[model samples]
Target chain A: MIRMNKFIKLAIATCIIFSHSSNLYARDKLDIKGFLTIAGYHSSNDNLGFQPHLSSSDVGYKGDDEYLTLSKVGLQLNYQLSTQFELVGQIVAQKEVVVDNSDRIKIATLNYSPTSSLLFRIGRFAPRTYLLSDSRLIGYSNNEVIPNHDFYAQLPLSYVNGADLTYNFGLSDGVGTASIFTGRTEVNINATDGNTLNSKFKNLLGFNLEYQTNNWLYRFGYTQSQLANSWEQVDTAIQFLTLVSQDYPSPLVSWTEGKEFVEAYRVKDKWFRYKTLAVQYDNSIWRVRAEIGDLAADSSNIPKNKNAYVSFSRTFDQFTPFLTLSAIKTSSPRTFSKPDEGLVQFLSAQSNQNLAFGLQQVFQFAETSAYNQKSISLGVRYDFALRQDIKLQFERKHVEAIGSNLWVVKDFSKIKDEYVSLIMFSYDRVF
Target chain B: MNIRILIGLICFVFSSVASAEILVIVNKNNPISSMSKQEIIYIYTGRLMAFSNGEQAQPIDLYDGSQEKATFYKITTGKRLSQINSYWAKLSFTGRLKPPLALETQQAAVEYVVNNANAIAYIDEKYLTDDVKVVFRLDS
Candidate 1:
C-alpha cells in the first residue's frame, strides 16, 4: 500500500477550511480559488490494482490503498500585476504516492497580453497535448468521474518548465487559436525493482490548434522530444551482452550479432513523437466528445501505441448521465528471443545458459510491459448544489495477456487476459 | 369560488416572474450601440475581450446560481449554470482566462457596469436606468 504524505493531509484540511468560508480573498488585484475532491474506488480483482496515471507506482486502488486512489485538493492564486501582465500560481497535493516537487506545483506562470488576440506566458505550465491535459486535476471541471485510463494513462508527462505564445483570431464565425510551446520535462514512473524510474525529456517542442464555437470545439496537437536519459535496466543488459560477445569461445554463431540486436533496440537518446485530434460538442443538453492519439518511437522498448475514446453525456436538469468507451493497442508489439533462438542455442551449447537466460528475461521484461486494454464506463453526475457535485461510475476493462502494464499485478507469471470491474465515487467542489 | 381566485392570483405572480425579459447593458459611453448574440456569447464566455470597435471590454455577472445569472446564461447560450461554471473552471485553472467578474445582485451588476466604461452586464428590463444602455435583449 502507498503511504499518505503529510502534504496531502494538510491539503485536505485546507480545503475543508476554505469550503466553509466565503471568498474572503477576492480583491480588485488578486483572486484566490480552491478545489477539492474526496474520492474512493474499488476493484473486483485482488491480484491486480489500478492506477490513475502511468507514472504512478505499483500500489493503487486495491487491498488497503483504496481510499487514496483519487482524493485530492488544490488551490490557485492569481495576481493581476498590471492590465497587461499577470502572475498565477497553483499548488495541488494529490497522488503523491511518489512525492515530487514538480508534480505538486501544477502551474506557476507570468502572463502578458499586449492585445486581446495575442498572449505570452513563461514558467512552469502544462503542455496542451490533449483536450484535458491542463485541467486534469480539477475534478469538478471534468465531465467524467474518471477520465479514460487507457488514453490518459499512456503518457506520464504532465507539466513542463516552458514558455509559450498563443494567438487568437476569428474564423468561420468561431474563435481560432494557435499556440506553440518549448520546454524540458521529467516523468517519474515505476521501476521494475519497485523503485522510481525517472525519464528526462529535453528540447521538447509542441503546438496546438483549436477552433471553438458556442456549441463545438475542435483541436489538433503535436509534440516531439528526445529522451535525455538512459533506461538503466536495458542499458545494463546491453553491457552484459557486449561482454559476452567479446568472451565467447566458439565462432559457430556470431555472438557479436546478438549484441548488435540489443543495441539496436535500446530506447535511450531516441526521439519520440505524439499527435492527437479531438472534438467536443455541447448544447447544454447533450455533450459528446471524442479523441484519438498516437505515440511513436523508433526504439522497441518504447513501442508505438494508439489510444482513442468517445464519451456521451446528457443533462437532465441537475443530473447528467454519461457513457464512455475507450481502448488502447500497441501498433508495433515488442518481441524477445526465446531459448530456441540461434543466439540462445549457441550460448547454451557452450554451457553459458545462465547468461543467455538473463539476457532473454531482461529484454522481455520491458517488451511484455505495454498497455493494451478496452474499457467501457457508465456514470452519473449530480449537481447537488452550486459549485458542488457528486459522481459515481462503473467501469469494466478487458485486459489482454501481457498487456496489463497499466495495472499493478502481484505476479507477472499469473498475468492473463481477463475482465476487471471497477467502481468509483467522488465528491467534488470548488470555492 | 374563493379558492379558484387564490389559485389564479398565484399563477399570475409566477408567470410574470418567469416571463420577465433580460437586457444586456453596458456603460452609456462605451461607444458601441448594440451587440450581436454571438458577440455577447464571446464576451461572457471570455473568448472575446474587445468590442468590434477595438475597445477593450470587461464583462460582469450576477453572483453564482442567482436567478438572474441562471436566466441570463439560459437565454443567451442555452447552457445551465453548472455548465457555464465548468467551462470557466477549465479556463481559470489553466491561468489562461477568468470568468466575468461576479457581483452579488442585479443592482450590484448594474452599478459595476455603470461605473466602468468598458464594462458589460445583463439584468431584468425593469431595472433599466439612464446610467447604462441596453446592447442586447432576450425575451422569455
Candidate 2:
C-alpha cells in the first residue's frame, strides 16, 4: 500500500514538473490560478471545537480564542497539452484546529476529452457529492463565508483516488450532466485520547446527476462504500474487556467471555451509503437554495443521520445579505440491551450490576459517533473589489444530545442543551 | 416646485439611468449573425466555449466594476456581478473553464473583438462600430 501511494505521488510530481517546463518554453497553454481565504471566528464557549464537517474534524475555532484555523490558500495549475488531453493539479495549505498546519495536494488528475460532450479523469479528484464540492475550499466561490455546517458536517471523505467519467446531454430545454466515479481513500480518525487511527474505505462508488436551465438548477447524488475496520483502539479495548471477563465464574455469566460474542460486538466491515438532493434558483436579484441528505451505515457502531438546509439571499448593488436555517438528526443502532435472562439469573447481584455497567459504557461510546444539531446563520457580503469580497456572519447553534456532547472539544460536563453563538469575519479573493 | 412636477422629474432621472443598453458583438467575419438570449448566456458563462460550427469562441469583458459589464450579465444571465464572479472563481480552480478575458476599457474589448474572428464581447450600445457585428442586445 505504501509503495502504491509513493508511486502515485511520484507520477504526479513528474507530470507537474514536465508540464511546467513545457509551459515555460511554449507559454499561454499553461494556466496558473489561485485563491486565498482569511477567516477568524470567536465562539461563546471555550474549547468549542465545532467541526463544520466530518472530513474537517481538525478545522473550526478552538476554544473562545479568535483563530485563523479556517483560513486557507490554494493554487491550481492547468496544462492543456492539447484539445483532447490536459493535466490539472491543485494544492492547498491550511491550519487545522488542534492539529498541525499542513500543505496537501487536493487534486492531480490527467484528463481526456474525446469530444466536447464527454470527459474522463484518472487520479485524485474531489468527489462531486455536493453542489460546491470542487470549490468548497475556495471561500471566494461561495456566497456565504462558510457553508451550512449541519448539512455538510456528516460527510467523512472529501476526495477519492480513482477514475471518473462525465457525460453532458441536452434535456428538453436544459442541460443535463451525469457523472460516475469509483475509488478508494484512507481516512484519519482522531480519538478523544489524542490518538489518530487510519481507516480505509474500499469499493467507493458514486454517481451524480444534474440538470440546469436558465434560472434553475437541480442535482441528485448517491454514493456507497465499504468501510474496513482497522482502528487499533477498538482491538485494544476488546482485549481489556476479555481480560476483565476472566474474573467471572462461568461463560454465560461473564460479559465478553465468549470469543464469538466478542467478535459480534467488534467493529466490522460495514457498508456506508449517502444520498442527497439539491435545488437552486437565481434571478439576479434573489437567490434561493435547499438541500436534503441522508447518511447511513450498516453497522450498529456507526450512526445514521439526516440533514437539511435552506438558504436565501438578495443582491443589492455590491452587497448581498443571506440567511440560512440548517439542521441534522442522528440515530444510532447501538441501543442499550440487557444481558440474557439465563445469564442474569445465574450471576450474583454484584456481577450482574457490573455487567450492565460495562454494556452501558460500550454502547455509549458507539452512540457518541453522531450529533444532533440545528443552527440559523445570518451574514452579509460586500463586494469591495473585483473578484474579491468580505463577509461577516453570526450563527446561533443548538446542540441536543444525551450522554455525550458531540460538538464540544473538551469539558463535556459543561455542555448541555445550550445555544452557542459564533461570530465570524472573512475576506476572500481570487487571482 | 409643484409635487406632481417633482415626482415626474425623479421618475425621468431613474428611467434614464435604468435604460442603459448593452450590445453584444462578434467579429464581422464570423459566420454567426445573431444569437438567442439563452445562447448568449451559455457563451458568457463558459458553458459553450465553441460556436455551432465548431470554431473556438473567446468571450471578452470590460473591466470588473464597469456598469456595462454588470448590466450585461444581469440582463443576459440573470446573475449579479458577484454571482458571476463566484461562478467563474469556482470553475477557474477546477480547470473546467475560464472566465472571459477582461480588457481595461470598452474600446479595448471592441478592438479585440474586431481583430479576432472567434472573439465575442459586450459594450455599451453607444460604442457600436462597423468593425464588429452586433449579435445580441440587453437593456438594463
**In TM-score terms, which candidate is top?**
1
Off by over 4 Å in 1: A1-16, A20-24, A97-99, A191-195, A243-250, A255-260, A334-353, B2-7
Candidate 2 CAPRI assessment class:
acceptable
Candidate 2, residues A206-252, lDDT tens digits: the string is 99999989889999999988876656756755664554444355556
For each candidate, give its TM-score against the true structure.
Answer: 0.92, 0.80
Clashes in each model (backbone N, CA, C under 3 Å)?
0, 2
The local lDDT score (0 to 100) that residue A264 gets in candidate 2 is 43
**What's model 2's overall lDDT?**
0.72
Give the per-residue lDDT digits (tens) of candidate 1, residues A308-346: 999999999999999999999887564444323555566
Task: Estimate, for each residue in B1-140, the C-alpha lDDT of model 2 and write its tens digit.
Answer: 69999999999999877666788899999999888888778778876566666666788877665888777887787777777878888877765555777777999889999889889999887788999999887766
Enumerate the candidates' DockQ scores in order. 0.63, 0.32
- In Å, residue A287's CA in model 2 sits off its true spot by 1.3
Question: Ten-residue segment with the worst summed lDDT in candidate 2 chain B?
Answer: B47-56
